[model samples]
Every structure is written in C-alpha cells, then in structure tokens.
Target: MKTSQSYTESGYTHGHSAPVLAAHATRSAATSAGYLLPELEPGMSLLDIGCGPGTVTLDLAERVRPGRVVGVDPSLEALEAARDEASRRGDRTTDFMAADVAELPFADASFDVVHAHQVLQHLQDPVGALRGMARVSASLVAVRDVEYRTMSWYPDIPGLDKWLDTYRAIARANAAEPDAGRHLKSWARAAGLEDLQVTASTWCYTDPESVHWWSGSQAARVSGQTFARQAVEIGRSRADVEEMRRAWLDWGASPDAYFAMVHTELLARVPARR
Candidate 1:
C-alpha cells in the first residue's frame, strides 16, 4: 500500500479534479478491457492497479462474480471516488485501497489476474511496476495504454498539434512515457513476464454525442488546474493552453468531427513457481 512518501512521490499529471474524474468515469470493461475479457472466468481473483473511479473495476468485478476484486491507487480522492462508485453500483464485494504500483502490497501469486488500464503512461517506472505486477499475479497480467502520438482527428487543428507536443513534453518531464502503448512488450520482457500476447484497439468517437462529450471533456482537461499548472511549469504559456482548449471546442462544433485514440493491450503469464 502507498505510504505518505510513495503517494507524495507519484507525479500524476491529471489530478483528481472534477474534469479528470468525469472523463475517466466513462471507462468500462467492454470499452477498455475487452482484450482480457476472453481469459477472465467467473471465479478468478483480480487486482486492478490504478483503478481511478472504479467504473471499469466494477464492470470487471461483474465479469468475475463471487471472485475477489480489489482496486488500488495512490490517490485518496480517487480511492474515495472509486468506493463511492462501488457503493452506487450496489457492489459489496469489490474493495478499493491506496497503493503504489512500483511496490504492490501483496504476496507472491496473490491474485489470479492483475490488470491496469490507461495507467502505464502516467507512471514514471512502468517496468518496475510491471515487475511488481508479475510478482503478485499467479497466472496473468493485463495492461492497456494509449499511444498519445497516434491519436488522430478530423479537420486537423494546429492547436491540437501544439496540445500533443505540450502534453508529451509535460509527461516526459515527469519521467513518464506519454506513448506507453508501444513500450509494453519491451517492458514486459524486461520484467521477465512470459507468454506475452499483444493486441491493439481504437476508441472511435464520430457520433455527435460522443464527439461533443469527448471534445468538451478534453477541453476541460487541458484547461483544468492540474494540466494548466504543469504546462506553465514546463514553459507552456497560458495562451498556449487556451489555444488547446479552443481547438477542442472548435473541433466539437464541426459537423464532421471525428476522433480516434489507439490503444495497446498486453496479456502476459507469470512464470511458474518451482
């Protein structure tokens, strides 16, 4: 579990602000964890690392009924929100805790499966984190993350390009990889995980409602206090941040607006015990 030091050391770019939470609350198992669904059974204990609002965790819990589901993160606000979500969903079995990925507070082979969604990109030591995951997981470890640079949109806006560059710079400054999707294989190999299977997926937002929601939320995220403050700390002016917000809003108003984010998911089996 995360002590005060580990929690304080986590350089999560998107703080648990309303905007960030709102955006993350949309995640579900079908949308984010489909690649791992086929392998999940009704009685496999699972650990969700970096489970933000517990939306996806709850969905995954539903898939593994009667099996223990625990979601862990370093953010107290996020853990509270996750607990609230679990309660709202009437799910009594799932548990939420504050834990660091680099030092998972679990014994070896503690869970049948370990999963993380859109998490590796924000972590400073993803390889170390994977090693911890491999240590705890008895059978499988699943992870998915987006390649920020692979994101494509319709009617390309200049500010969107600037947004990508600025965001990448800020993430790198935090010692995190903004394009973590492409590195999962190498990280898993370095962590000594075996029998790796990798897959790719995309979230396409073309419908009017989806486009509007995605764009507006992104605008809020870029203009939010956490990102805005970090941007400035990394030499990005307020004007630059405003341009990113405007670009998202402008894209939302376009009748032909489209956005697709590419994600990579990896499932690796833990090495057998002697």
Candidate 2:
C-alpha cells in the first residue's frame, strides 16, 4: 500500500513470495508431505526461514499439534502480516520474529526441523545461510529453491524477454543473487551437510491458457515487488505490465503452449550433535 511504486534499493520491496507460495500448489505439497519433516513427530520444534505471511508456520504448527513453530523473516511488512494472521487464528503455539536467515538468534541445535522454501535463490551467500540452519537445527535442514537462471521458454511473446531481463537486472541491482538456484545441491553439500538428499521437481502447465497465464501472473507479481521501488522514470507501467501478463497467460492457454517449471530442494541431517 505504499503510495509510490518507485523501485527501492532492496529490489524486492514487498514480501511477495509468501503470497505466491500461499496460492500455489507447493504449499499444498508441504501441507500434505510435511515439507521434508518425515522424521518429525508431535512436540518437535520447527523453524521456517523467510517465513512470509506465516501461513506455512501456522499450518505446520497445526500439523505438529502441541508443538511450537517459529517463523523468521527479515521483512517487517511480512512479519506484520504474519502476526495479524496468527493473532486471528488464536494460535498461541505459533510465533514470528523479524530476523535475518543467515544470523538466526536461536541457540545451537535449538530446533528439530529447519525448513526453507524458495529462499536460497535470493541469497548472496546461500551456503552461509544453510550453515546457520545446520547450526541451529538438531536434526534436519531442508531447503527448496528455484533456479531463476534456468527459467526458459519457447515462442516469441512480446515483452517476455524484456520482463525477464528487467526482473533479473533489478534483482542483481540489489545485494541479492539472481542465479541462486543454479547449484542448490552443491551449496547445501558445501555447508558441511552430509547424508544429503536432493530432489528435482517440475510443474508443467500445459493448459495453454493457464500455463502462460500462470507465467504472466508470476511476472506481474514479481515485477511489482522487484521494480516498484524505482523512481517514476524507471518504474514499469501498469498497462505494459498487464499486456505482458495477458500474453503470458494467453500463451499458456494456447494449444501450442507448453511450460516446464523446475524447482529443487535438499534435505540433510546435522553432521554433528553438539
């Protein structure tokens, strides 16, 4: 609700990831599969890195009933939104804090499960963050990230390439790394994590309409958070943005349209019991 859509120095101004994740199928996967917390049982502690809007935290807390869940995020806006939702749910077991993922305040081996989704791709030092999570978790460290640099497409949609370029440019303009997804497994392994397991997942939207629509929708959502902080001169237009969005969706929904969405994650056990 900030009046100006000017791009900010932070690149990603709003906590848009939370919303996108909340609406997408990935959250459902977490809800059903426990998001790689297989060894976990009730009363175990859980930590969510970059916990936007608290949806995953609250839901996981519910899953592991009578257990405490802590959601940590760096964005005050995301924390505020999460706090409001937690209060409304009257979930006393769920709590959120404003904190950096790389420098968690919790004690060593404090949690049983430490989970992060689509987080490392935004980090400049993903290995450091994983090390932090490894230090804090007593059992497991799970990380899910998308390789943004691997995002590819076919057919020439007007403005499609520009959108990706601007998006990557804005992301790199900030202190963030835009290609974080390229080697998530390597980073997790490099973080001193052994017994590592990695999985590759893909979401193919062949609806032609919905697949492209999904892309456009994603583009619009990301650009708003990524580019809105710029001055008016550098700000993207709503109309142009909408056009790209429509094109994307139209492409997705078209008969010739095909989409391959790739995401990867790593699950590792704590190497040492401190």
Candidate 3:
C-alpha cells in the first residue's frame, strides 16, 4: 500500500516497481496473515488498507465468503495489478480502490474488520492511520509490520550491513519508519484502540527455493528504481548500491545462507458503542 496524504515527505519508498510487486505477490494469507485467520468468520466484511497487489487480500476474501471485501491503496499502479490478479483468479466480487490510509473514504463503522499489512511502517503518522482504521471498523482492527533493524542473517556477508544502513537512511529520508514492528502496540494504544493482542512471527529463508527468490528479488530491488534511486538521493554512491546487489547474489548462492525477518502482529477490538 502507498500513502501520500497528511505527510510532507516524498511518496512511497519502494515506488511501484516490478521487482517490488513480484516480491509482494508471493505473500499469501496463510503465510502472511495466519495470525488473523482464527478470528476470521464467513460473511464478515473486511477492508484491506494498503493491500498492494492484493495477494493476501484476495486470499482473505476467500475466507469471508458472501461478504464484501475491498482492497485499497494510494498507488493506482498497485491497484491495477491487484485488479488484474483478481481477474486472473476469476474473482468477480472483490473490489480494489484508490485511497490513502490517512483518509479512508468510507462511512463510520463501515466494516467488520479493518486490516493492514506492512503498510503502517511507511506512514509518517501511523497512529493517525490507525485512528482512521478504527473509525471505520465496527469489530476489529489488525495490523502487521516488520522491524528492519532486528532482521538477521547467517554467514555475515559483506555489504549486507551497508545495505541495511542505506535502506534505513532512505526510509527515514522519506519520513517513514523502517523499524515499525516494535511500535505497533504503542501506535494502536495512541490511537485509542483497546483490547490489543500482540504476537510475533518470523519469515525464514534458508531453503534453496526460498533463499533464491528472496535474494534475487532483493538484489533486483536494490538495483532497480526507487530503492537504488533513493539511496543515491540520500548521499549513497551508485557503487554502494551495486555492491549491495552483488552481496545479495552472493548470499543467495551460499549453501549456508540463512535469513530471518521479525514481524509484529496486533489484533485489537474496537471499543463498544458508547
């Protein structure tokens, strides 16, 4: 998802590039949204904010049959891909729209559940985004984000550290929080949401297939537009970006390479009507 409202910084950090979308399209509800599955019930309306390519959104729509499921993103390009994915899946009911998390164009209490994945981290005011989600959610609000600073990998590869540093700098330059997983609880509380249940999950890439895809996509991402472009804008040299891209490729080829990303999930219930 992309957000350009209520912020002075530049647009989405990753932009709407092919590599970014390819990486995001691999996410599924089972893998990315397992924590919220137990709470899902059929016939419940859902609003997926920042639903990027809508891979998870489409999977989620399957769980809530005969119910409305809408995916929203500030990036029209992302929405177009999402719509195309829906069409490919032969899903006729799911709807994709262009909207920012800062100002959802929906009535109060319009959805049974409001969810966002990897979206809040990109917002300058995540708490404000949560408030908007809470306003439109009658029952629950769920969100997930990764803490980039804690991401770990084995076989201490060269240039990886530089990659992390440069990525963080770029995100900060855009006024987005790269390490946002740890702050989900605080953000939700600050939004006045109550009954929060927080949990943690990990995405490990050690298997051959997983490692290849993860590393290749990252290399492509850093070498491609947006990330690479932003790194230069933040005083990093093109040589530094190229080095990181090479590092990712090297890591992918190593048999002992392992990577783990930590994500925090928050499930909060909307306060009862007063």
State the local distance difference test value for candidate 2: 0.67
For model 2, how does the per-residue alpha-carbon lDDT over 1-274 read when each residue is reduced to its tens digit?
2221222224342335544534432354354224475666788889988777777677778767777789887777677878887888888768898878767899999998898876776666678888999999998888777666666666567666666665566555444556665587788778878898887776566664556456665655644544444322346666665665566655655566665656776788886673
lDDT of each residue in 137-188, candidate 1, tens digit only: 9999999999999999988899999999998998887777899999999999
Best by lDDT: 3
Candidate number that wins on TM-score, 1 or 2: 1
List pairs with backbone clashes in candidate 1. none
Flag regions of model 3 displaced more than 4 Å. Answer: 1-10
Instruction: List the RMSD of every prediction in angstroms.
Output: 2.5, 5.2, 2.1
- Backbone clashes, candidate 2: 17
Which sections of candidate 2 miss by over 4 Å?
A: 1-26, 29-37, 87-90, 152-156, 207-216, 222-225, 228-246, 249-258
Candidates ranked, most accurate by lDDT first? 3, 1, 2
lDDT of each: 0.89, 0.67, 0.90
Residue 77's lDDT in candidate 3: 76
TM-score of each: 0.96, 0.77, 0.96
